[model samples]
Target: MTLASTGTVIEVETRAGRVRGAWRGTPGEGGASAAFLGIPFAEPPVGDLRFAAPMPKRPWEGTLDALEYAPTAQRGDPGVTLIPEPSIPGDSTLNVNVFTPAPGKTTALPVLVYIHGGGYFAGSPASPWYDGAAFNRDGVVTVSISYRLGFDGFGWIEDAPLNRGVLDWMLALEWVRDNIAAFGGDPARVTIAGQSAGGGAVLTLLGMPAAQPLFEAVYCISGAAADVSVDEAEAFGRRLAEAGGVTPDRAGLSSLSEERVLELQKQLTAPAEGGNPLDGLRQFVDGGLTLGPVIDGDLVPLKTVDAIRSGIGADKPLVLGATDDEFSMILSEAKDKLRWIPSRYLLGKVGLTGKARSAYVAANRTVAKKGTAAIVGRYLTDRMFRTLALRIIHARGEAPTWLYRFSWTSPTFGMAVHCIDVPFFFDCLAADKVDAIAGDHPPQSLADAVHAGAVNFITTGDPGWPRYTAASGETRVYDDPSTVIRDGYAEVASLLPS
Candidate 1:
């Protein structure tokens, strides 16, 4: 490692070559850290590499400037996601952003590598919520990685590789193993985590036999798993190609521009032209993600839950959970309108009918009191995330697993909601737009509690909470005054089949 004359520019040597970064704060301050942004782990996935697996980046000639945020897979933003993920324009999108307090110190501190989520279609690693400054301030070296998104990344083509996004993740982890030590991170003591689709990504990696050597721990926040089978993936791919007037193979699909592919993807994914609003809810309930890792029986052998039950990642410690109301905000506009409809009728729209709907409502009497929209929204949250958490816990059996619930309702949104727990997890309350959802006086103490547990889990493998066991499903609830409760997911058990 070497520092330039003014001391702001820090240089470190990696297998690919030397790269330069800049200091984020006063050199000696406790919160000070160095950021190396847009460090490529693989060659640009363009031209001949367009629909193929990510090829390892070759050694560069001189000091590669890794100062600015890299181009992102998420092109032209759709307004803004719950997180402020920006889409910089460029082709070398497969990269990483590394933040560390000790650049040349050889400290070998524990590492935290985060993956961003946008339903396996859109998301960027450049979000302020994913910055590793906070983690670096706490003595943990941090990295946020980018992968191919949407059709170019995951769509199945005859000549193109499947799950290119998944391959990007593995190659990035390999980069961490080979180069993170240059940034003072321990190669062997790595912890990978993600939220939403990113959360699902970590869980997917957790169950892969080949990914066992990549990391030591996981924390899935509001995870939405996408175990799309090969048949389903190919079906979507063929439709997508047909929409673009091309063949469903790498050579043909790659002929279409990235923007055209994205447009076609939206067209296919959009709800039917005249379909009812409730149909959107059913898609999430019945359809897994349209584009993601396929059960190719090679890279990804089985569904994530089944793989976990078979004990692929049993040795690694895991902490996973969702907020009290993940997608309830999605139905916020319909609250007054939904009130006119019967709760049971609304439940029936999503296939919860007869004694089943009655039993579910009876079990969730508290949420039921919140009205029909709340019930439907809670059902969505449970069907996709909270219930999935329970399934994973039971599957692990005796594995070291901790559960947590981010129950802090956003003052503006009026429920915990999707992406709300992320700021707390990253300890980034002061980041852009946090006030829009959390209101003016979002609690810092709550962030302290949540981030403290996350840091504990990353550093020591235990999250300072009771392990989740089949006999007693203990869970940590992160509210203003966070507390532990046994069987925290009991209310969701009614959703389980008899």
Candidate 2:
């Protein structure tokens, strides 16, 4: 599958029949050796097909166009800088983008598949920042995929399927398993990498029986395996039904307009009288829509934390962590509202109190800069991200897990912020078509270092950092020019409720 001819459309035989992808040139006017775009991994999930498990795309008779990307899942206009646009109605939404060195007779190269994150709400694999042309330049096959989002993807309808979005990801992985060899990719050596919600997906996948054979390693930027519980999900369904002016029955709920459904989802983030916007509707427990992973017997049978604690996922290798201030992005509007709430009160929600709560708050206060805003942001970030990272690491005793904290704040925003590590990790300083997720332009060296670390982990099981275990308790702190390895990020980890 190596050595593709540059500047010619190469016929790729997919399960959906033959498609002609543009032949990326080798060091010519354009900077690609070989690449493919807009490849369909599953059938379109639109209209009657929406909310259903992904079905195989029916094969075509002639060559299908693979030059343009397919439409993505629906998203509201948040007006953020680097995020991608939502898919247009009636366009096929289940597709993949693959970049590979011309399939010239080269040896099998490691494959890296990227899943975009937007809290299970927004994001598409076709975002410009995700262009894998550079990875192809280094002889690694890269893939980015699209999946259903919002109520269309995560709503918990009792009669309908659960976790349809997660199912989409699994189907794409299966496609790679059955077809990636034609693109010079070794399916057995695949690495599933993602950030935020996508990172969470990686953790859930590790716990999923159906997802085990798809990849050998995983790299999660700032997500966890936890999601909304069945009870909470049903409540969200009721909310959606209420918004639609109907009863909370499956048929009644499914009849609502997509726009109306999204409006209900937006309300999930709105400040409530005494409730956190993310409290019950958020992905905290397993099983239900709204949550991406459920404890369905065949898909996911237990909480990811429980599975890791029980040694169910010990054989799998993991690279996971978060930005130093991952919650800064989410708190942009509620910074003031967050000021007086003590970390103790928040920690109590997760069931820790007295000495544990006091200790956690004190530790966070130390690292947090002197300012109400800074401390609050730091506290929230630790509660959400660092706590989860430490939980997964502490609970799992089988796999050799690498842990890290992204500490460099983007100069543009003056904070590392949520999703700030993405562009640098992808080496996408100049990539275009960014939506809400874009960050400041990164220095070439910064992108190189981050991407190198990620690629290193994908190619080899190590990311040039120490592994976190009960014994050594080592950690990696990733910054602009250097990646430092040390021990005991417990100051932040300790803040998590037990």
Candidate 3:
């Protein structure tokens, strides 16, 4: 069915049921877009279905009200962070929100499916920053999805399905394939994009055979694949169960209340007293409850990096990147504390003490001028995000890949930090609560460039840059005046241990 004109309510028939959506603006006003919020793509993962792979939604009777955002998996307060995440309460968490240009038709517009990122532990599609109205204005269909998080999604159990969060993503893609047509989206032209853990999800999907056909391209921002081994994941699950005073099996897990489970998740993730601020960062790297996709020998037969090297999804175009100062934002609250720790002690945590640490510190000193804290932050930034991104780029055999680095320093943080590029990429810098990161008057030109790059990649499989080649290692650096640089981190790369 064709979409209704601006300011009009329209009904569209989806395979699961019918939905009513409202247009956000008039076509002639340049703000034309239709938003369909909280449409379930899978059965509510509640009660007996809690830890299982997502099941298809049972067809509903009457027109479903696709008007408001749905509740996400329970999480704690974000507390003065760059993003503002609003939590609602409900069991219908396996849902998606779609935005399309007004007067939708069977025109087969390019589709961009965005998965949110919050370390894979907490995130919501309800963030105002995720508004797809701008993409709609550009004539692209945008989708934001919600999935099970924390232990409920990633805690590995012998009886429960592994990588249930990844399964949720797969089911959401299947829903888009089966139903997006009604929303005027072309499933065949789908580009899957995410930042941080969501970027990790895109990479994980690229490595999975089942997910190959779900998307044609990938736009990963600061995403690195977390391939926890089955044994390791199961041990983490057991530890969690023991901490919560329950059995480690699916029966025991399902028996606990969602509140209880979330509390356990918090206990596992909370920073220990008397520990450095980097304690949380250390836990994340060491596979905390925020454990991501597991290499389970079936769904994920190999690590994402290994799979990419072995040619999984090598034919698809890829755009992957990280910010210049990813770890700074992560340690923003403890920046001053970071100064007190000796460079040797800080480097010791990651096995970079003595000569290795010396070499790394020397190599990074040119860029990290703020002493030991800056050195360690840059080290973590490269080790966790930049190096991993380059590994993926180098392993992308024959596929046209473009690499980028976000370098736009935030006025408050003094560096381009984690999740800072999100609002820019979505063109939602003007949204409520976004000023925390983007400042009072964020750069529109930067947002235009970033958002346009995404749109270009989604529509044409190219993002206005030369395709990455191992020989040159060309990368686009997004700053005040974006410029391309050759091997931007070659010096740091040389010092890294193989």
Steric collisions counted per model: 0, 24, 0
A best-first ranking of the candidates according to their TM-score comes to 1, 3, 2
When sorted by lDDT, best at the front, the candidate numbers are 1, 3, 2
lDDT digits (tens) for residues 1-498 of candidate 3: 123335567788999889998887664577578889899998889878989889999999999988878767745565223677777888889999999874347979999999988878877888888888888878789999989987888898768889899899999999999988888899899999998888998999988888999999999998967788898888879888998788898888787888888788778767787886456666665453347888999998898888998899988899999998887655656668767877668777854667766777777776556766666777778878888888887777667899999999898778888889998899887787667776898898999999999999999999998877878878888988898888866646744446
The lDDT for every candidate, in the order shown, is: 0.88, 0.71, 0.82
Better of 1 and 3 by lDDT: 1
Question: Candidate 2: TM-score?
Answer: 0.87
Q: 214, model 1: CA deviation in Å?
A: 0.7
Residue 219's lDDT in candidate 1: 88
By lDDT, the best candidate is: 1
Please give the distance, in angstroms, between residue 371's alpha carbon in candidate 3 and its true position after superposition: 2.2
Error of 2 at 470 (Å): 2.1
RMSD of 3: 2.9
lDDT of 1 at 323: 93
lDDT (10s digit) by residue, model 2, range 1-498: 123345676666766677777765654444465556777777777556766789878777988878776766755463232455445444578888888764533357899999888777776676667777767766678999888887777777767787888889999999888888877788898999988888888888877766888999888888845456666667787777777788775567657776777787778644476875545423232122254565555576677787667776677789888888776555556556656665455445444468865776677665444445565556567666777888888888757799888877666556778877787787766655322334444567766877888888888878887778676677777776566555547677566555
Q: Better model by TM-score, 1 or 3?
A: 1
